[model samples]
Target: MGKYIQQTDMDAYRFYLASMEKSLATIEKYLRDINGFCSFAGGRTITKELVIAYKEKLIARYAVASVNSMLAAINGFLSFAGYGCCRVRQVRTQRRAYCHANTQLTKSEYLRLVDAAAKTGDERLNLILQSICATGMRVSELAFLTVDALWAGRAEVCLKGKTRTVLIPGKLQKRLKQYIKRHKIESGPIFVTANGKAVNRSNIWKAMKRLCAAANVEPGKVYPHNLRRLFARTFYHIKKDIAKLADVLGHSRIETTRIYIMETGEEHVRIVSKLGLVA
Candidate 1:
C-alpha cells in the first residue's frame, strides 16, 4: 500500500525524490508547482480534470510556450505523487510537427554579445556567458558546472538528459584560469551567489537580459540558447558537415541538426543555372 502525497507530505516528497534519484533543483520545482495546484484544488485531493482546468487557466494569462512547460512540470509531479498516467497526454500525437527554430544568433551578432559581456567587467558572468557562446552549452549545464568538468580541452555537459562534450578553445582555458584565481573560486560550482549557492538558470537568463540592455542589443537575440544555435551555425559554416554538428550537439537526429546549418547548401552557380535566367 502506497501513501498519498497530502498537502503536507514534505517528508514523503523528499523520500520520493530520493527514490526517483531526481536532482535537488528538479525536486524543488516539481514540489512547488504541484503543491500550488494541490493548494488551489482545496487541500490536495485533486483529479485530472482539475489539472487540465488549471492548465487552461494558465493558458489564458501566459504564452502557449510557457503553459506547455508548466504542464510538463505538473505532469512529472503527478507521476511521482503516484498519479501515474492520470495526467492525460497533452501532446496528442508523436506525428505532430514541432515549430521550426529560426531564432539563431548570427556569428556577427554573437561577437557583439560577447563583447558586451566583456565590457561589463563581471568576471564570472563574463566567463560564463563567453564560454557558453564558444561551446554552445545549455544554461542549466552551466549552472551545474564544476572545474573538474573541464578536461582534455573539452567541456562536458549532460544536456537534455544526454552527455555531450564540447571542445574548449585554448584562449578560454587561459582566461578561465585567470578568472578562477581572481574570484578565489577553488572548488564546487564555478557560478555561485555570494553565499556560495549554485547560480540558478533564471539568474543566468536575467543576467543575459541585463547584459543585453547594457550592450544596447535587442533582448530577443541575446537568449542563452541562442549561443547553442550560434555554435551549430559556426561549426556548420566551417565544416559543412551536418553529421559532425549533430555529434557535437549530442543530437541523435541528423535531420534536427540540419536545420541549424544556415547555408541552404545550394551551390550559388547551380541555383542560377536552374533558373535559366543565367543565360
Candidate 2:
C-alpha cells in the first residue's frame, strides 16, 4: 500500500530542490530522471518492488554510472515525496583505473579543435574552448569568467552551494583580455551570444561537435567536458599533485579527481610494461 505518484508531488519536489539551492541543471536532471521513472511506473502505486524493477530496466539500458545517477535522482524524489520505503539501492561498480581510450581527448586533438574553431572565424567558440581547457573550469562555470575576473586573474565560481576560485593562466589571461577589448565587452561574462546572455552548455556542446570533422577528431571525443579532462591530465603530468589538482577542479573528493586524470588503457599498459618485472 503506497501513494500513487502525482504531478503535484513532482512539482513540489522540484520546488523543494530549488529551495535547497540546487543548480538549475541539477534540478532539471533530477526531474528528468523522476519523469522517466514515472513513465515506467505507468500509474502503479509506488512500491519498493516496482522501484527495484525500474532500477533493473535502467541498468539494462544505461551504463553503470548512468544507472546509479538515475537511481540517485529517484531516491531523492522518493524521500521528498514521503515514499522513502520505495527507495532502491544503486548497483555497485568497481572504480575504473583507466578511462576508455575512445573517449580520451589528447592535447594535440584539443589544439586542432581550437585551430579549427579559429579557421571558422568563431572567435567566441575558440576562446571558450581554450578558456575551459586552460583553466580546467566546468562549462557551467564559464559565466563566472567576466571581464572583472579576467583583470583580477581569478574567477570566483559558485555552484551547488560551494564556491571555488578558478585561476586564469597568464597566457590565457592575455589572450582573453585582447578578446574582451576587441569585442568591447566592458563587463559581465566574457562569453555570450548576440543577446548578451551567458552562453549555455548545450550551445557550447554543439559548437564543439561541429569542429570534429574539421579537426579530424572523433565526434564522440568532441565535448566541453573532454577539454576539462585534457586539462586535468596535463596538470597531473606536470605537477604530480592530485590534491592540488582536485582543489583546482573544485572536486569535493579526490576520487572524482582521479576519474578526471585517468589515462587511456593503452597508456596504462605501456607504463605497466616498463616495470621490468617480467625480465
Candidate 3:
C-alpha cells in the first residue's frame, strides 16, 4: 500500500463522502458494501482480481442490477483509493425498461382500487391513495407530503436528484382540503403511522398489494410506480400532448419522459398481429 493510502485510508474514504452528493443512506450503503468486499478479499490494495472475485460472488447471490450496483460502489471507492481499474470487463446484462406489462388500469379498475382504499376508512390512507392515483405522485413523495405543499396548489418534489413543482387541479385541491379538515392534520407529513412517524415506503407497497387483492386486480399490475406510469401513459393517450405530460411529471428532458410513454413489450406482438408482411 502507498504511504498516503495506508496512513489515511479512512480519511480518504471520508473525502470520497465529502466530494459526492449522495444521500446519507446511499453513502452508508456504498461504504458498508465496499468495506465488506475489502474484508472478504483480505487485501490492503483494491485490485482488479479482487473485484473480479467479488463480482462473481455477488452474481451468484443477487440479481444483475443489485450486483452491478454493488460493483459500482466498490469500483468508485477503489478509484478514489487510487488502486482500481479504469474498466473491469464492463459487466453486461439485458435490462428491461418496464418490469410489468402495461396493464394500464382501466378507469373502472382504478376506481376499484380507490374504493378498496376507501374501505380502510383511515381517512389519511384514503387521501394518500387517492392523491397518488389522481396526481401520479410517487409513494415516496406522498410519504413526505406536507399540508403546505398540498395547499400551495403544486407538487414540489425532489426525485432523481431533481426538484420541481407539479400543478394540481382545482378539484384535487378541493378534495384535499376536505380530507385535511376531516383528519385534523395541520403540519408535518400528510401520512403518518399511529406512532406519528411518517408512513414508510415498505408499508405503502404492502398497502398496494392488499388494495390490488381487494379490488380483484392483478397483483402483477399493482406496483407503486405503475400508478405514476399509468398516469403518464393514459394521459398521453387521451390528450396526445407529450410536452404537457412532461411538464406535469417535472421532467426536464421530454426524452426522459418518453420512456414512460412507450408501451409494454406486448406492443410488439400487437404490431406483429396487424402487419401481415412480418409473417
Candidate 4:
C-alpha cells in the first residue's frame, strides 16, 4: 500500500503555491481544504476509495459549488504530491438559470446601506460601497482606485495576469474627488487606513456587515462582491449588451457575466407570465 499523506507534504505544497504566485486568500483557502481532507483521512493511506468517500461526505454537507471547490483543492494537492491516482471526480450538476432572490442585493437596499453608513459617520465605508457598485470592480481591486485614476475618470486594474480598464462614472468621479479633497488625500489610493495602506477585503467586509441592521438590509445579501453584481445587473439592464458588459467586468467568458445579471426566480416568473400564453 502507498504511504499516508504527511505534514511535510502540505508544507511543500504551500511553498509550491507561493512560487506559483497564488493570492494569499487563494493559498489559505486551498490549504484549509487540503487540511480538511487530511482530517477526514484520519492518517489512512490515500487511496481512490478514500478520496471518493471524502467527496461523498462533502456532497452530503455542502452546496454543489462548495463541494466542487473543495474537491478541486484536493485534486490539485494530490496532483502536486504525485498522488494523482487517488484524486476523485467532482460532482456534476446542471447550471442554475436564476439567482436566489434572498441573496440578491437590490439597488434600493444598496442606497439604504450607503445612507446608513453616512448616518453613522463612516464616510469611508459609504464611499467604498459606492465605488464598487458604480465600477463593477472586484473587492480586491479596490487598491487600484487611486487619486490619479479618479482624475483620469478610469482605472487600469491588473489581476491574475490580466488587465482591464474600469471607467469611473461622471457622478461618482465628482463625488470621489470631493471626498479626496475633504480627506486631504494628496496621492495614491483614496481608500486607505489610518496608516495609509489600502483597506483589504476582510476589513471592508466587516465594515459593510455592521451597516446591515441600520440599513434594514439582510445581512446575507450585504457584501462587497454583491456590490459588483449590482453593478453588472444595472449595466446590463441599461446597455443590454452582454459582450460589452463582459469586457467591462473583465470576464474572459460571457457565460460568467450572464451569472452576474441573472434575474431571480420570481422575476423570471413575472416576465414569463407577461407573455400571456395562458388563457
Residue 59, model 4: lDDT of 89
Best by lDDT: 4
lDDT of 1 by residue, 131-237 (tens): 77787676777754566654356666664456777777888878887776788788766778889888877777788888776666777777777788778878787
lDDT of candidate 2 over 1-279, digit per residue (tens): 247899889889989999999879899999999999999999998989999999999988999999999999999999889999888888988888887889999999999999999999999999999999999999999999999999999999988789999999999999999999999999999999999899999999999999999999999999899999999999999999999999999888998998988888998899999998995
TM-score of model 4 (CA atoms):
0.95
Q: Count the backbone clashes (under 3 Å) in each candidate.
A: 0, 0, 0, 0
- Give TM per candidate: 0.65, 0.95, 0.74, 0.95
lDDT for model 1: 0.69
Model 4 worst lDDT window (10 residues) = 1-10
So what's the TM-score on candidate 2? 0.95
- The worst-scoring run of ten residues by lDDT in candidate 2 lies at 1-10
For model 2, the local distance difference test gives 0.93
Error of 4 at 200 (Å): 0.9
Poorest stretch of ten by lDDT in candidate 1 = 92-101
lDDT tens readout by residue for model 4, 141-206? 999999999999999988777889999999999999999999999899999999989999999999
Error of 3 at 272 (Å): 2.7
Q: Write the per-residue lDDT of candidate 3 for residues 211-262, one digit (tens) a residue.
A: 8777888887776777787788888989999999998877789977887777
